[model samples]
Target: MIHSVLESVMTANGIHSINRLHRLFFKLFAWGIMGFVCAQTAYAVPVDTKSYDPASGVVVKIAGKTLVMGWDTPEGSTELTLNLSGKGALVRSITVAPGNGKPVEVLRDIDPVTILTVGQRDLKKRGGWTIFFDRTSRKPSESGPLTLKLKSAIVRSVGRRCIVELDGLEGQSFSGKLRFTLYAG
Candidate 1:
């Protein structure tokens, strides 16, 4: 019935080839639907990744406020937490660009988001970020994940993004984009 209706419409438009016109109309219809869907969700799409252990949990507290973040079982594994302080929008986005052309991960909430970026947020108070990392390696000098317990850190916006300068026990320092909630009243 649909094919007959399409054929009648095409024939009414003085088009002799029904097969070619049918295919063209179908392609146009599919493209229109795709375009509409993409446009509706273009601004809401943020690159994210949440493939981590579900048993781990992070508890974030600043002043009297407390927020529980996602899973991260860092026990027995090298757990490196950076006490970051700086100026930017207070956000619940945690991202790590493991360097070496790695795909950035957005570990946003307690669920999973991996990569955090700077955005226009309404920050109420001034504070810092305490970020955690699972060190894949033992030594800081090695080219893998390093274990460090650094505190009193600060994040400075160098250019397009904001980064927190990291210094470990081995005196080796590295920079990474760390954006999270700064709730110090």
Candidate 2:
């Protein structure tokens, strides 16, 4: 029945040759298939959403700047206090560089009289996270590029600030940069 109807429509349009009719039928079938494919693709929905992982890192700030240590005079010693805030993060290690020079394991003066001590202050509470310089003490005898092991449960939320003190340098001039890394696990 559909074939008869198609034949009648072709006849009404003055189409008589079977070759022209076959060509027209195939063209219409191709166009219908192309339209269906385009429509399906245009309205297709994603099977699943793309997954992503959150960024992880510790943030260190010193008066809102990365470079915090500096000396103004040639005789007096300078002290630097840095604010560290991280979520379940701890200080893995702290290193010091002498202005484009190699990093030293210990921060010692040329005269062997000056000493460096690194300490930590809770800043808000007590009996919280503490900074340990060496294996058995809170304030390590030496300094410079030392890995101060942090108690795993340290820095619960707001965290604490590192207090560094330079002593015994009565008449010396120094300039350097300190680099510290924090890790969250």
Candidate 3:
């Protein structure tokens, strides 16, 4: 009877140990699967997007202000023009919005300048555009809220399209949108 009791006790302990090991293995597997799923979901990229053509209509907003912005190249022209002449449309009006959602006119007929220029690879030509705010009118009525209205002549370059990037206007970085349209003339 004593031997039988001892045998039974040993069998029960063996069964318990096996069960504990199985449970530990299951927990580890579950954790690994959960971690993999979380990683995949976090790093997944979004799909399905619309194409933006700068030629149609481009509106750039910076610090809660809208500005007209785009580029134009002469027809059958291989070179980029820096001088803000009849070559392209310049930024005209600048509107500033106050904290209370009220817009105040700050600037009109704003003069734009080209700060940087780069040459084309094949033609070895350089071209770009930049607009500068008046030094006297740099101060805003409030802390934030500014907008810009940009106008440019239609781009007429055939081989390469002009690229217009707006920056260093109000703050450290350039924030805005661009719309471009191609015309026969």
How many clashing pairs per prediction, in order? 15, 0, 20
lDDT string, candidate 3, 1-185, tens digits: 64565467558786676566567779999999999987664431121113324443332222112223332223221111222222223444444443435444565554454232222222222322222322324333223322323333222233333334332233223335332332321
Q: TM-scores across all candidates?
A: 0.24, 0.20, 0.22
TM-score order, best first, reads 1, 3, 2
Candidate whose lDDT is highest: 3
lDDT (10s digit) by residue, model 1, range 1-185: 87887778787865656776779889999999999987664322121223222222332222211122322222211112222222222233554433233324453323212322222322332332322232324323333333333333333332223233333222124444334422211
Q: Candidate 2 residues 94-169, lDDT tens each?
A: 3444555554334321112223455444433433444232233543343543232211111112132222222112
Quote model 3's TM-score.
Answer: 0.22
The local lDDT score (0 to 100) that residue 8 gets in candidate 2 is 81
Ranking by lDDT: 3, 1, 2
Off by over 4 Å in 2: 5-16, 44-185
Model 1 TM-score on a 0 to 1 scale = 0.24
- Give the winner by lDDT: 2 or 3: 3
